[model samples]
Target: MNITVKFFSSLMEYLPRSVEGNAMAVQVDPGTSPRQILARYRVPDEEVRTVMRNGVFLPEEDRDQPLEEGDVLTVWPSIQGG
Candidate 1:
């Protein structure tokens, strides 16, 4: 299965290939969970502050949501206070 990932802030710099924009396409196994996807990318669990599936916010408990082909998952890290 494949999913679209959109990163924000410092996360973009960690990507292997520099994406001018804030998103990329990644391939995952069928029935992949959000936690599994992030782990594959080596993204620290704490760094992921927000999780969205196809433009909808998902609760932490729902991180196990199974991904489908062409699903887009956007992750945003929390910004610290000024």
Candidate 2:
């Protein structure tokens, strides 16, 4: 199956160099979870402050859920403002 993964803010550094932008199309086996992708990219759990799937916020508990084909998994790093 294929899905799109997007990293925002500082998390964008984790994206593959081949990826032109913050998003990349990736191939995954069936039942692949967002957590798996994060781990694959070496994205630290503490760095991930938000996770969205297809524009909807994905709760931490639900991140283990299997991702369907064409799903968009977006991640954002922790942000700080003065």
Candidate 3:
């Protein structure tokens, strides 16, 4: 299955070189979920501060929420300040 992924802040560096800004498309198994995708993409769990599935916030406990075709996933990394 194919889905859209948008990473925020420092997470953008994990994206492909050709990926612009913080968004890109990726392929995954039919039953892949937000957390699974992150792991599959090698994104650190700590860096995944937020998750939005199709414009809705996806709770950590709900990581197994089924991903459908054309789903849009937005990932925001935790922000820190001195």
Best by lDDT: 2
Q: Can you tell me which runs of candidate 1 are displaced by over 4 Å?
A: 79-82
TM-score of each: 0.84, 0.93, 0.86
RMSD in angstroms between candidate 2 and the native structure over all alpha carbons: 1.8
- Residue 18 lDDT in candidate 1: 58
lDDT of each: 0.84, 0.94, 0.86
lDDT of 1 at 55: 88
Candidate 3 lDDT over residue span 1-82, tens digit each: 9999888888888787888788888888898888888887799888788899999988999988779989999988875689
Instruction: Say which candidate scores most in TM-score.
Output: 2
lDDT for each residue of candidate 1 in 1-82, tens digit (9 for 90 to 100):
7789888887776566756688888888899988788887799988888889998987899998788999998888885677
Which 10-residue window in model 2 sums to the lowest lDDT? 72-81
Give the lDDT ranking, best first. 2, 3, 1
Model 3 stretches with alpha carbons more than 4 Å out: 79-82
Candidate 2 lDDT, 1-82, residue by residue in tens: 9999999989989988888989999999999999999999999999999899999999999999999999999999875689
Q: How many clashing residue pairs, candidate 3?
A: 0
Regions more than 4 Å wrong, model 2: 79-82
Could you tally the backbone clashes for each prediction? 0, 0, 0
What TM-score does prediction 3 earn?
0.86
Cα deviation at 38, candidate 2, in Å, is: 0.3
